[model samples]
Target: MPRVRALSGPKPRDAPEPSHPMPRHLRTLTALLRRAETVTLLAVLCVAGGLWAFAALAAEMLEGDLHVFDETLLMALRRAGDPARPIGGPHLEIVMRDITALGGITVLTLVTISAMVYLVLRRQRASALFLAVAVLGGQVLSRIAKAGFARPRPDLVPHGVDVTSASFPSGHSMMAAVTYLTLAVMLARQEPAWPIRAFFVVVAALLAISVGLSRVYLGVHWPSDVLAGWALGAAWALLVWLVARWMGRRGGIEPDRARPE
Candidate 1:
């Protein structure tokens, strides 16, 4: 009876334990996103392949197809917008004309000059080099497609714009799209703010698209030609973006600048 010793200090409980597993809904959502990404990649590859095939077909029927399509679109645009007729405002006509000029040397020079300046400022020699390759690669692809197709420019429509290159897919359209899209990617990398980034990208894309459309409005290219240009140009742009992303991940290259938070 010196203090009665406790029979047992403690006893283990034998009851079910609470579970804290991840919610099924969240798990399902995660899996869905991953699956979506995979599907998107597959679709991109399919589009690229399809564009390449179409480019080949266009090449085969280049001169003939360009002539027919250009004529048809010319009539449609003339009835729709009538660049020459001009609805009323002098400003509108001037604006449209200016946009028409955008697909030519002006846009190319702008992008090249800007890229050069960016490289000089940021000291991103590798990125600059890759950018150059992407631009030239797009150009070369355009030329090869044109040469292979040997499509002539529109004669029926009385070309509103001058031409030199063979025209299955519009060269100006391709170049403008590639250049603008490339610049968009570069800026997107540097600017993290989604709204600002989206604004710039949309602006660039719109400018490119307008320039391409202006060609048709001007009675120079077929709608199909411009469309093909867009597809091919977009494919090349995505290819460049993938390259940049790869380089960044590997730490071999840094984008032009960091997005300011």
Candidate 2:
């Protein structure tokens, strides 16, 4: 007698069995590798594009092509016949100063130190070290670039804030981008949730952007300076992130949460 089927139960669907199990396992690995490659490629493109933009801006600035462009924008922020005052009045100037302070050396130093301590406590020594290098490296690069360019600050208006460095790239803006973005990526990569990662990245980006704008608003930096700062900073952060990610995969650094196989 044939075995009786259970009519109330759902019937199992047939899946063909491969003669070897290797192919099935290989397919999953292949898919994972493809996804990883795609992501890395995109990151490389972003880094390259940012560097290219920075170069273009630098060339134009050196040729004096951005002089009128920078002057027009900088002067527009002042009150008519009052190059000493910003258009938004004393209160707006105050607000801008406060916002700009977010990118200042004191604030960034405090933030980086705090983060490094937290990472140390968490035993993420490699990541903490990487963050430090990323930020400090950006600072070094900023100083070198400024010295190389030797560009002067905007003299079109009395600066809303004090500035004493070369004005080709706003140090505050560049540091803000480097510190915030690097920290954001370090924190985001450790988390498994996409929304959490997105939140960190978005907030970091906004902070960097606001700092750059505040520089221009304060009349301490040429518009091109802020733009160049952002470009270089972003590229630096991404390049460091790529290196960190690569190291993480090799177990040379604190690895991210394991990718799905």
Report the Cα RMSD per candidate.
Answer: 6.6, 7.5
What's the C-alpha lDDT at position 204 in model 2?
91
**Residues 1-261, candidate 2, lDDT per residue (tens digit)?**
999976686767598665665676798999878988998999999999999999999999999999888988888888888888888888988999999999999999999999899888989998899889889999999999999999988887778777888998889888899999999888877777778887988999999999998999998999999999999999999998899899999987898764463
Query: What TM-score does prediction 1 earn?
Result: 0.73
lDDT of each: 0.71, 0.89
Reference-based TM-score of each model: 0.73, 0.87
TM-score of 2: 0.87
List candidate 1 segments past 4 Å from native: 1-53, 56-70, 79-94, 255-261
